[model samples]
Target: MPSVNRLLHPSEAAKRLGVSAKALRLYEQRGLVEPGRTEAGWRAYGQEEMDRAAEIVALRALGLSLAQVKRVLEGDSQGLEPTLAAHQAALEAQLRQLARTVEKVRGLRSDLMQGRAPTVDELMNLQAPLREVRVAFELPWPWGGELFELRDIRSLNYIIGPLGSGKTRLAHSLAEALPNAAMLALERLEDDGVTAAKSRMDSDPILKSRVDEAISWLVEDGANSSDALVVLLAGLEADGPDALVVDMIEQGLDHATQEALIAWLRRRGANARPLFMLTRSCAILDLSAVGPDETIILCPANHSPPMQVAPYPGAPGYEAVATCLASPEVRARTAGVVAWRPSSGRLQSLTP
Candidate 1:
């Protein structure tokens, strides 16, 4: 009897799994497997890998991509199960609709064969009701090659900038741009404004209570419509989970606060419609200054001048700004001004 000691090459494993070796290579490219290697640097696979290969084929039969199958096998099943289930449900729904459509077509064929006078409504109304399927397309913003499209907006986003550098202006602009956005003015959050709101947002009970309060306000004000966009604005940063607060921190947000906010955003940012816009002020506003996980910086036309801009919830709405700012001509005009460093402050464009 052959024992499990036989190490299989990728080709052998593919043959055993009843799939082509090309399929296994494709899976590997997608981080599905970390194959071992022989002394000659040839790829080798173990029994575990082979088993996973079989599972991959099975999942593909169910219409899963290699990336999706790898996600399933990796045990990070948080969102995959629902997604797969949704796909199955959609397929079932489509099959039913197709069956009805086929039956209608057969009936129409019979009517035509009988030489009956076909009414316009009779032929047109035979089709099923057209359901509006929401599909999001990634549209590129003209400003600095930025891309903006519908996505799940998170409850927390870090907007880093220096103090009084038009942070609030941008934030307010975004608030106005976002339709029905729920604005939470962290009145009690700032040291000078509200010390307690900062502490309140840092805790789960207080945070939940405050969020609920904001929601209640929106509902009562008739602003909580289905298409309402919620903008959670917190002033004066505190280190805590689920708080979408931004402050001017030149070195980036405090470690604890940054981690908490990132985790919070990841969870709430999973929405499909992106109904929320998180606005806050960060001290460290340079996108290239810190690590990618730390900040999503919005750079100016030129990558220089290192001035930080607070991320307004929806201010500088990329789409609208792109329509106005979209031009290679603008960048070319501004190119000369980059080298002209001011001795005092931000430069004002003299160009008309």
Candidate 2:
């Protein structure tokens, strides 16, 4: 009798899961997913591994980061109740904000119909009534150097730094400091490699159609080029003379996407000014991906100048921000609304 055929090889497994061999290795490195290994030390994948791999691939395909995937998969599926509860609470807050926003828009529409020009002050007053409902907390501005206000610049700013550098924390503080602003958590986006790979899969007409639909939704959902910039600017204008904080988890964005993002930002900067808090591995702003802008000096928390390089290598400005915000003294000194708190996960406001 013929010997039973073994399950798929690593390469075939990757293909079946719609991921690259490298990604599989990375997943293994993170201990999030594992595959069988042969006595010869070669990687082997069985049906169970394939199923897990498919789940990993699908979660990633839905724009979850590897870290998030780990949390979802290995993180107390039985105890996911707490996370689910947190998410539900957050969603309810967003719903309240959206309801208020709709009312404001309706009032503005009625004013327009009555032939009244909506002044900035009038619009702001309309929004201010809802502000009283939010709790006030303080996050001292990060990097206490000198803030050089650049006026008439575009209404969306993107700041990038490596992980654990404090960008996310700083962004949360900034969002709290700026009234009428909304903070969005950035999801992963497809880079050139993934886009090309997906395009290649178009050889299968059915798969291609599905891929196209996914791409369309990704952009429309505010993860793509035009929509991302557009929504950023629109949010700023609607929020009024304030900043918007985007908590970006930069995962699959490649060089080309970075360049396109920079160019778009520059064009917008020419008109209105906004603040962006981007956290990532490298500074794509200075790269050939887009035209470079002069680095404006922001005041550091200790009155120190913004260093040309990260004071701590690999960490960057985020560290400075984190150090300041995490201080109990600084937290006490902060005035105005503090929307997010990293430690307790308590958010004071319900604005979307």
Candidate 3:
């Protein structure tokens, strides 16, 4: 237990609470927990604040959205059932795995009793590995049919690169190659997609309900309502494909909405399906907030094969990844900027 009078800086508090400082800021933005201000006016968390944050973290771990957490903290249990079910499913999966391990151990003991020695491979097979979601396919256009193979996919993957890089093609190949994966493209932000999304929502009451609930949650966390948000959430319902690839997830969202949407996506916890998002917004991929379950894939400017990048300053391609990400404000300002392929040239030119 921490001392009652002890005060922790935001980073220290986040470390102690096993979360990111960005998460703490989001909690504050949602008015879920209020920390104190030191003489320098920096946010400081006391013991009480730590305890409150711990509660919020536990609720979030159970797959409750921020709005759901707010409601539960306010003494209403309105929306806990679905989240609780999801949490239970995760726990039951673990339980089944444990049972299998127990059976393996029992078989090992039986073999010992029969004076039989276990083989090396048999001994190694006692423990189960995490799910291996892999995709392998020939590279799409721009490259000369290079083989691309990706394995050990994480829950949250970001695909990033500069404007003219083949990142978009790579994302497309991934969407086409991955089993049961679908790409929610930039069309989701277009007027036709918005109208079709609304029509789908109108026809599917369950999808509409989920979207409404998610929108309500985002709205409470400083997001404004727009067709962009509606269509995005509609495409991202829990009942969608096994994996989703999003192209420019922050395409039409404002700063506040982008921030809130990212926070919400992170809070989805175990209920979140694997998402491969091609992002250029800093808010959508905060390097400091990248967690164990997140992976960053970067496409190089020179058209070298896309590679996984470690989320640290000194890693290879880290600078390029950082350069690809622009603040939401910057992204909004440059929304109308377009690059062109000049006439008659095998070699591309950025020289104007």
Candidate 4:
């Protein structure tokens, strides 16, 4: 066994604490952790630092902001009540979902013992919640008038594909087909668009309040206010839309912002309005964060019909979805690099 008093390198310390080395550095920067230094000037985390870092990580896992974490670490409990309440609500929602799944499994097992085999659709239904909304329509251009049927739309649905894969077309079609759904387009970020969005927010006090709360939450997660984000949030929290299809939901937002946005959406629980978000950013489409009330649809590079992809690592089209998504850091590095497509040739030329 390792010595209890032994100090560890940054990577080893982070491993023990179940966090990233970058996160350790962030804590140090925020003055939440103070590590010793080697003679070579490398950071060294001793037992004291490790213990403190563990506390920070626990607070963060509870959705506390870094600032809030700092405050709590300094013995301030004034803000803990609301944060804990939110966490409790989220936990309760998850427990309810789990209970429903357990009941379904029990029923299925009972059927099996009685010499009854469940249908494929019935088996699949046991895995996910019954979708409350669905859309069926003919796919638009690039796809040859193929009928597309999206069943059991979840609270959060991600529409993802590479450039020229017709993901945008799918999103638009979904917006038109879903009852009372509207698409929040990129044009919302154009000049005077922000002003119009702000004007709408001003006209509605409840919406403005919700928007402000969301913005504050995002800021706590390291997001800064931008016209694009504000406009997007305005539409997300807007009244009267049964659902919303958002094109490039991560547009103009940084990695932190995307992470925060997804977390916030997940916490909205099962009753949140359904959202169809088109995204290429890994942060926004995190495979690990896809919940029971979430679904993923991938438009293949070959322009085949879009299909819902199971989020598991080895599921069909899961690799393709993973390939199409990039970390925000990688996205930032390749922001201007676009794949070349010949305008007048057979689409086959663009394949692999």
Highest-scoring model, TM-score? 3
Candidate 2, residues 1-352, lDDT tens digits: the string is: 1122576777777656655565576678768777888988888987777777778776554444455567779763443453356456656766787787888889889999999978897677664422232223433345443442323223444444333344555566656655666675543123443444444554556554544433333332223544333333333333244445665423234333433343334433222345454533233233212222323222344434333322222445645433332222232244233455455333434434
| After superposition, candidate 3 runs with Cα above 4 Å error | 1-6, 74-78, 100-131, 238-240, 270-272, 339-352
Candidate with more favorable, higher lDDT: 1 or 4: 4
Model 4, residue 182: distance off in Å is: 2.0
Q: How do all models score by TM-score?
A: 0.29, 0.30, 0.83, 0.70
lDDT of each: 0.42, 0.47, 0.85, 0.85
lDDT digits (tens) for residues 1-352 of candidate 1? 1234768988778767655565577568667776788899999988777666677777665544344566668775654564467557767777787788788778888888999766787677565332311212222232233323322233333432222233444444434444433334433233443344434555646554545544433333223322111223232222232322222221122322332233223322222122222223221121212222232323233322212223233445332222222122333344325354564334445434
Ten residues in sequence with the least summed lDDT for candidate 3: 342-351
242 Cα displacement, candidate 4 (Å): 2.0
| Model 1 worst lDDT window (10 residues) | 281-290
Q: How many Å off is the CA of 227 in candidate 3?
A: 1.5
For candidate 3, give the lDDT. 0.85
Give the TM-score comparing model 1 with the true structure, all chains together.
0.29
Q: For each candidate, C-alpha RMSD in Å?
A: 15.6, 21.6, 4.0, 6.2
lDDT of 4 by residue, 4-115 (tens): 4777999898767765576687688778899999999989988788888888888887877777888888888876887799889878877898898899889989999999
Task: Evaluate model 2: give its lDDT.
Answer: 0.47
Query: Compared with the true structure, what per-residue lDDT tens digits does model 3 show for residues 143-172?
Result: 768888887687788999998789889998
